[model samples]
Target: MQHLEEQIAHLTRTVEELNSVVTNQQSEIDRLTRRVEMLLQREAERAQEGSGGVVFGDERPPHY
Candidate 1:
């Protein structure tokens, strides 16, 4: 029936829109994941070189 066809069309359009949104979000998530991995690698290298700005819990601030 015509009504059923219209409903299918609307549902198809909505699904397409949602799929596009999900695809874009996945791309953004992938980019952010890569950035985090890079940062972690850099931090690890800095720690190995003993040049990282890591502080211990018992250490006081310079102004203390």
Candidate 2:
């Protein structure tokens, strides 16, 4: 029936729209994941070089 066809079409469109949104979100997640990985690697290297001067708990900073 025409009504059934219309409902199917509407549902299909909605599904497509949701799929596109999910794809975009996945791409953004992937990009952010890569950035986080790069930052972690950079921080690890900085730690190895002992240049970050990261303060630990209950420890005062060098300027303090």
Per-residue lDDT, model 1, residue 3, is: 100
Candidate 1 whole-model C-alpha lDDT, 0 to 1 = 0.96
How high is the CA lDDT of each candidate model? 0.96, 0.95
Error of 1 at 21 (Å): 0.3
lDDT of candidate 2? Answer: 0.95
Error of 2 at 3 (Å): 0.8
Clashes of each: 0, 0
TM-score, predicted candidate 2 vs. hidden true structure: 0.83
lDDT (Cα, tens digit) per residue for candidate 2, span 1-64: 9999999999999999999999999999999999999999999999899996867999987888
Looking at model 2, residue 61 earns an lDDT score of 79
